[model samples]
Target: MKGRGFIFAFLPLLLTTCIDPFDIGDVVNGQPRLVVDGLLTNQPQAHEVRISYSSPTLNTFDREVVSGADVFIEDENGSQVSLIEDTEREGVYLTPSNFAGTVGVTYTLRVRTAENVSYRSLPEMMRPVAEIDSIYAELDSRQSLSSLGTLLNNWGMQFYVSTGTGTPESNFYQWKWEETYQFTAPLAREDQIIQPICYQSGRQFNQLLIGSSQDFSQDRIGRQPITFVSKNTYKLQQRYSLLVKQLSLSERAFNFWSDVEVQRDTDGSLFDPPPSQIIGNMVRDDDPEDIVLGYFQVSAVTEQRFFITRAEVPASPGGPIGGFSSCVESSEPPADGNNGESSGGPDDGPPDFCYDCTLIQGTTTERPSFW
Candidate 1:
């Protein structure tokens, strides 16, 4: 019994070790790396380049903004445009509102930071992407571990896109998407004290989605999987909208994105390749040996938006999804439910968010134009 108890006591620690194999603390060590992400596309709009330092190792999601940088985008023909720092958003520099990239024209990005460290990217030609054919989704099931550590199957939708036939010059591609969905409260009041319905928006980022047609017999992209939405959440509870943007990438840019994808997907296991920084095209002006993180991409862009209504998905065995299981009313009503007043009143409701949807992050009472 004593030996069995000891083994059980250590089992949780062992499980935790297996679940998180990488020791990020030892690898990141709070060292700040310069990260620059810049893009110029064929669409006529205000282009942007973000300059910042990677968050301290311990806080990888938080960025240290690099401000007061002299940023510019120039073409091979000697034409140049200075990017002005957005006073509203630090570390972000923007081009003129009417500026746009021309297909077949080579572009380069240059930046000089407040510290006077200069960096530049190798010029890359903008390639034109074919128009997207169609965007669709399929009902599917995904396996996830429940809080009890048991594997559970969750229903969801897997999204795919078919793009134009690929030619040797147009084989490399990249995609990015954002989603907005409508959800409502479980309970409704006759009088509209607050908005019972709300819309939430989010983007799928940090995950590189790219494709190549060179290896296939038919030089076209068909049913290329772009993203997925699980019914485990309120996203698929009502109407959902997804906007996908397709970009044509140069071979060099494709290769850089491939390296980034590999590094992002890598797990520090014995069988996995050792982790290393995936270098981009940017190089330090004075010190070639110094590393600069992130990429500068110039591409032609095409985009489409698709919507999914709850009616399309199969009915859940447990009936319609409630706003949130935790959003239940308290046994005792508060005084003034308006603005979470706890004074005892017949209208008072428990769980503040159930009374007002805006309390939730990324939620808005205003209906989106697309909706």
Candidate 2:
């Protein structure tokens, strides 16, 4: 899901439908419309709300962060939790790690932009969700014609997940995942000592997964595909791991995300529906007539993770795809006896964090506590 991009793409259309040519001045002089994407869960963790602007008038649709905005969430009990701006992440406001809402308790989102314009979310109730019974990787074949259009080769692994019986009243569900893997550098330092394998991790940024038991006869869901990872890709070069978080959505939130998922799948297809705007849960309190985009959703999340070793994914005929067959080659030829490359960070450091421990295209050397 190209979250920001879709808002940018459909906004101009939304504006065209709501704005009148006779009132061109309103479109030109009116305050910019705000966009919000927020989610809350029963899990005790730092939650976030992202505030941005829709500049539909711009030549290119770009999200304008609304910084210096006052943001917070209030519970039915009247206790208010303040959210502080995450400076590193523009437009993001984070709640304290101790903050956690309870199931059945309704929460409201409140925001006041630097300009004094205020916004609020319709009260959303937190709901409980079924825990994932299990999550695992299936080394399914991902074959396609090669560049020469002559042969088809094995590609990647498709992940499958399952959940226990869900509550009848709270059957709607959505998924979010983070992926981590280990990779060794192709070339090392002048010292010529082999570098240890380093681990890197990253969260899936945009592929939205939403489902429900509304149409199913059973209360549980099983063997549903969650995602796929190409074999021999950097992520599959060594060991691989995945953590999936399942969140239970309210009816309103489900409908909103369902629309987004459908539109995403049908994008560019011949049967795709005409472009349309997705009206989210946020709106202009200053002016009811303003057209706003995006959603502020609340859910109860249950998460689980699984590890897939490099060997677990069957090695293809070409071995692990691209190079790495002989990383020892070095900048020049190794001194004959050492056919492999001798590489380490030019400077000294653990093989995991040669330069930085925190960043490696989402990989980190600090092993996950669960790992």
**C-alpha RMSD of each candidate structure in angstroms:** 9.6, 8.6
Question: How much lDDT does each candidate structure score?
Answer: 0.70, 0.64
Any idea what lDDT model 2 has?
Answer: 0.64
Which candidate number has the best TM-score? 1
- Model 1, TM vs. native: 0.78
Native RMSD of candidate 2 (Å): 8.6
Query: Which residue pairs in candidate 2 have backbone atoms (N, alpha carbon, C) closer than 3 angstroms, thus clashing?
Result: 1-206, 188-343, 189-344, 200-363, 201-362, 201-363, 328-340, 328-341
On residues 277-310, what C-alpha lDDT tens digit does candidate 2 reach at each position?
A: 5677777788876666667778888899788877
lDDT of 1 by residue, 256-353 (tens): 65654555556678999886666678889999987677678898999999999989877664345333544454523211121222333335444555
lDDT of 2 at 161: 80
